[model samples]
Target chain A: MLTEKRNWGWHVLLILIVMAIMLPVLFMISNSFKTLQESYHAILQLIPAKPTFSNYLTLNKQINLLRMVSNTFLMAMIVTLGKVATGLLAAYAFQNFHFKGKRLVYFIFVATIFVPFTTVMIPNYLVIAKMNLLNNVIGVALPQMADATGIMLFIKAMGKIPASLTESAKVDGIPNRKIFMNLIIPLLKPSIISVGAIFFINSWNEYVWPTLVLKDKSSFTLPLALQNYISSEGGTNFPLAMALAVIMIVPPLLIYMIFQRYILNSISTSGLK
Target chain B: MLNNNSQIEEAVNSRYGPRASRKPRRRLLPFLYLLPSALLLLVFMIIPIGYTFYLSFFNWNLIAPTKEFVGLANYVNVFTDPTNQKVILNTLVYIVLLVILNFILPYFISLIVNFFIGKMKGPYKILFFIPSLFSLVVGAMLFSWILNPVSGPLALFLRDFGMKVPQWTNSGAMAIVVICLITNWKVFGYNFILLLTGLGAVPKNILDAAALDGVPKWRVIWNIVLPLNRGVAIYVFILTIVQGLQYVFTPINVITQGGPYYGSSNLLYHTYLNAFVLYKTGNASALATVTFVIFLILLFIEIKFVEGRHKDAD
Candidate 1:
């Protein structure tokens, strides 16, 4: 009975911490639906007196919010697909085949994980510009697709596959490509999904590179659009900005919800490794 | 028939290359498989880094026809400039605060979440981790609303309680603190999840024995669990430094613009300002090269200390 009481105490404490952490987010959502006056009201209110969709309407009318959403989604999907495919092929080769310079190649690939995009931003921009891809979504997505973290995670995941399974297939006259497709790819589903989800979230949230590369307002992703909106409007239009924030956050949140298990599993396993 | 049989045998032997000779060619297939990714990395990552290094010595505005080679002049300017000094100081403070908070707070939170959350761990983790899914720009904007002195909820609540709330964005030190808070809010969950996994890997038998021996819970964690989980702790430590430096760029650009007299600008943001905004590609490249060297040093240390330990244990 005493232990039960202590447990309840801890539960309440944990709940309070969680609430405090989530307050800004909750307030954003609540204020997003509030009238402009209520959103700017002096007193804090968790629930709006009268909820309205006017803010969302304003965002759509002003910023073409739907277009930005679709743009972000498309960029994220392309980047994720590219990263997954490249990461999988590279990981499979590293795990299955012995090459003379395998160690050196692996080192080069893994080293990029530490090389923050900031360090390479200027040169990458120049390269992109020279290629005439400036202000293009493809340009923004292309450089981001080659992710070191994705390769590392995939390699770790592939390492878990039993060597005997592939060896037996080989002995039975199965080719390497066929084994990768028929056997390894099937086993890699969870890691692939998790890695894909991670890449998608990352690309969706990416701000700095896209901001530099993409100059056209029409080519803007959600974060860039929201930033422009804030700078142009300043702080006066609180509800409208909050509404935009909601739109920017919802997709990644939904993705997280759907793939929470795989994401968490991958994170934990990667840490252990 | 005999001649035909010998010819077939010779063909098979030539093709197979006597097994030993086959090994060399077998190694080439992996290289073929690795070509696409390697090419991408070379073009995008490796070449860019080399270019960054090369640009550090040149006086170029990125569009100018001739980039005059001014070898090490940009590096000298980076060291001597006062604004760059402030940026470096701000970056150091940001990294220190981030490492401490990110390292300590998340560890404790993980402990609580791991030991105390019980069956509700999943729900709790999801709730805490929700903030991380938001883009840093969105988060900074959201907090800007929440921390707006005039119309913000916290200000109003404080006023009602006869307390004072500082103008968060206008002040320099306070802005940095606010930025740190928001960053911690968004980032803590990732490290928490990492530490929790580390704790989970602690040997159950040793923990049970510690409990039986009446070793206090804190002691068991500090002395037993922590020592055992050093690899993860170092990993989290390195991540805090790396991601912390990178994460501050978004908020500074979006919310502060290194505002209130450049209080929040770090080396990364400063580099952006130099290259894009100010069109001083030389200075920016120099700064980037310096920061890259710092990162390489940190990575080397991690490899030597953390990964080196793993090797020793094996």
Candidate 2:
């Protein structure tokens, strides 16, 4: 009887934490369709009386949601491709080749992990301005592609591949570039997907860099556009803003839901230690 | 490749032989492949860090033709300024509170969840981890609408019960504190999943032994479970601290803008405002330098304290 009671206690605690985590999301989704007056009614209910799609319609018309979505998708796709290609090449080099200043150079890259991006915001802005890439997707993607963490992660994953694979390839008269592309790259797909998922989410969510660099409203990502829309209207359009918020969150959430199995498998095995 | 005859010739003639001689070149390719990463670190990371350090000593602005060095005057002024001092205290308090609450809460939650391994666990983990999938920018925007004191869901819910809901983002210090708390929620799932993975690694036999020995449930948790999971605890600690720095960005930038009255700026956001908003590149650089030093000190402590334990355990 005592053990039964204790089990119930743990179950109750679990339920409460789950509730705490889910409460905001539940509230957001529920209020998405509620009328403004009903939304502001004195009771916090999880259901709406008259659920409508007008807020969603209003958000689409006002925010240019489609263009922003396409821009974000295009940029995320480019960043993912660049990160996977360059990141894999870098990792293969670290794992397969022996060179001078190798350990020292890699450590230098790792050491900068703590160097906050704000430190480089001014310098990067200047560089982007000089390159005449402002308001361009390339400018947005390039800065993000300069990712040390992705390179480091890929290198660590590559290091685990048996050295004999490379030796056997070399014996077969395979060139280094061909070996990396044809042999090594296929084996490291899981690592690529795992790291790629993280990078995709990050680039999609990025605001400050994009905000500062991209001056054109049409080029703005969802977050920036939504922020500007809300602030300009003095935040009065609660229903529309909430609707836009739902839209802004959907893409990354969709990607995550689809790829979550891969993410979990890779992370559990990677020894994030 | 070397000729077949040379392999036999070299094998007989040399101490290291053909294979040993080829080892360095093989290792060398890995480093060459890493060259682009090296250049990026040098250009983007290392040089910028050094520049920030240099800038901190001067009253540098983008518009200024000449930068005048002011030694440690900026640091002294920041430390002495009542407003700046309060911001630092508030930032530290928030970080400490988050580290304590976020780390232990997830560990215990994972501890309980790990006992259920099949159908129940999969859906439960997904449920808990889903919200973390949303980007911080979107999550912040969503919450801003929910927390609006006048027209937000929270305010409306309060008014129905005939209680006045406090203005969370507008009224005094509580606004900044509440915003920080909201930011903490977004990262909570990521930390929980990480802890769940760590807890999953513990040997079930040992736990079974504890149970067989008639050990009390709380005792099993305290003595058997917690110590074994020290590794995850350390990992969660380090990652949480790092995430804490970036988390302040959304709250400071969107909801508060470091305001009702400069009431919410932290070291990183203050540096951002200086560099971007004020265009005071030099002072901002100085501020970045300060933040970098603080990060270094904390990182060193984490390495020495947490990572050192892992090394010792291994």
Candidate 3:
């Protein structure tokens, strides 16, 4: 059809446009390797001339980057586990049960997705503080335990498991819990992993709630730690900030890369569905 | 009442049903599973919303031993205060700019990439989506440095031609614009993917059929593509305005903190400032309640719109 030759025009223009769109991210990676002097003076360079690892050292010294990374990882893990567990149980109930007031209960859980965090930020902070969870990772993770999105995603996932499989298991006198554990759980592995990735990334990038609770630098998540570099005084140290930025982006980026297809596909399909 | 109902049910089960004896416990199992998520939803979400309302009626500095009930005075303050007036206006501006940058921009970009381009949409999508995964804190820092008027890369490039970069962070309106730009960069690709995938659902032969009849490309898109993809379009439109409020918060915090005399502050950030920094608990709650009402109204509007579109299609 000669479509390949005609497509050359489209490819050339898109390549240039995408490069412009991607320049900031490219700069973010490149500038992390530069000295403070070159970062300021050689501003447009896509690659650093004299690269150094000193920025990483300074980042560690200034804020103990490793500690923040661990704190964030722990917090996200707890939150993701909590969401997935609750979501699985709830989704199983919704999928299998014909309980009274099920519609009301489903709406109650699913509707929270529409409730903006800002409207409830103050009360959530007060509640966390009252639990004596100030300056704690658990404080950041607790209120986020039951996510409605995970419930919605899981319900859609469970709908795909053929009903006859569960029905025959029930006929054999198998309890619902065992059926869930053995049959549904293994079948729902892909959904769990993709949903887990979404929850983990959301929790990892969470800044507002963590900023409210984790005031101590030692307890801060990576996004909150960047706040130290963002204030007027800390903005002067460009290279270290870039280094910290690079460090802060890596875990979520890695998760995203590894789970990219499943993640994007499920998000789009679930939203449209 | 509970004892009477169960006693009656036990009598019925004894009389008629050995299998029915297990029905009560079976009904109870689902509730037991539903309890944990429901309890969390109550504590973290439902109860907090109610608490926000209760606090809105009382004046508290959060340091004091007692809260004095003022009853609607805090709501009055949110409405009467000049700073809050500016913040409410700023919130409206944010909705507009966010819709433009996040929704409309991605709409056109998705159209171009899907209709005009031929191959390897996946790779381009991945490149754009790569930014969406990172923290907006990173985006805030990235844009602040790149658009820095003086030593930033953009400034340095423009200076070679004796051009000067605009000092965006210098003013309140410009600060808000810059914040919107930063979020657009972070959010654009995801929305692009959504719309493109939605567009991909339109039958290719319909477009080709229209084209063979000498119909313009825009006609085919408007008549065929847009009608089919309205679901994703509406989802993205509301999402842009709703989630956009929160997305702009990080940039506002990292860049402006609602500074230059509450110039760039929107309703959400203003509420945060009132609660935490100023410690005006009642005032913040009032603002929070107002923001909630606004969001509810937006949801109501969307429901209405979706129904109306459904009727027209029918």
lDDT of 3 by residue, B1-314 (tens): 54685586668778878486668779798987788888888888998889998899999986788999998999998889999999999999999999998999888878878887677788888887877888999888988887778778788888989998887766899899999998998898888888888788777898888888988777888888898888778878887888899889999999889867888899999999988999999999999999988888777766666666667556
- Over 4 Å off, model 1: A1-5, A232-236, B1-25, B116-119
**DockQ for all models:** 0.63, 0.42, 0.58
Stretches of model 2 off by over 4 angstroms after superposition: A1-5, A34-38, A41-50, A232-234, A269-271, B1-28, B115-119, B305-310
Which ten residues in a row are the worst by lDDT in model 3 chain B? B1-10
Residue-pair clashes, model 3: 0
TM-score, cand. 3: 0.93
Q: For candidate 1, what is the lDDT?
A: 0.82
lDDT of 3 by residue, A172-208 (tens): 9776777988899999998899899988988888888
- lDDT per residue as tens, model 2, B115-196: 5322256766777777666656656666676666666666666777998766566653675566556666776667777877
| Fraction of the true interface contacts (Cα pairs closer than 8 Å across chains) found in each model | 0.72, 0.47, 0.61
| Stretches > 4 Å off in candidate 3 | A1-13, A233-235, B1-21, B305-314
Q: How far is candidate 1 from the true structure (C-alpha RMSD, Å)?
A: 4.6
Comparing chain B with the reference, what is the TM-score for each candidate?
Answer: 0.89, 0.85, 0.89
Q: What's the true lDDT of residue A211 in model 2? A: 73
| Candidate 1, true inter-chain contacts retained | 0.72
Question: Candidate 1 lDDT, tens digit per residue, B187-287?
Answer: 88888888888888777899779878988777988888888888888888888988888888888888788877777788888899889988999999999
Worst 10 residues of 2 chain A by lDDT: A229-238
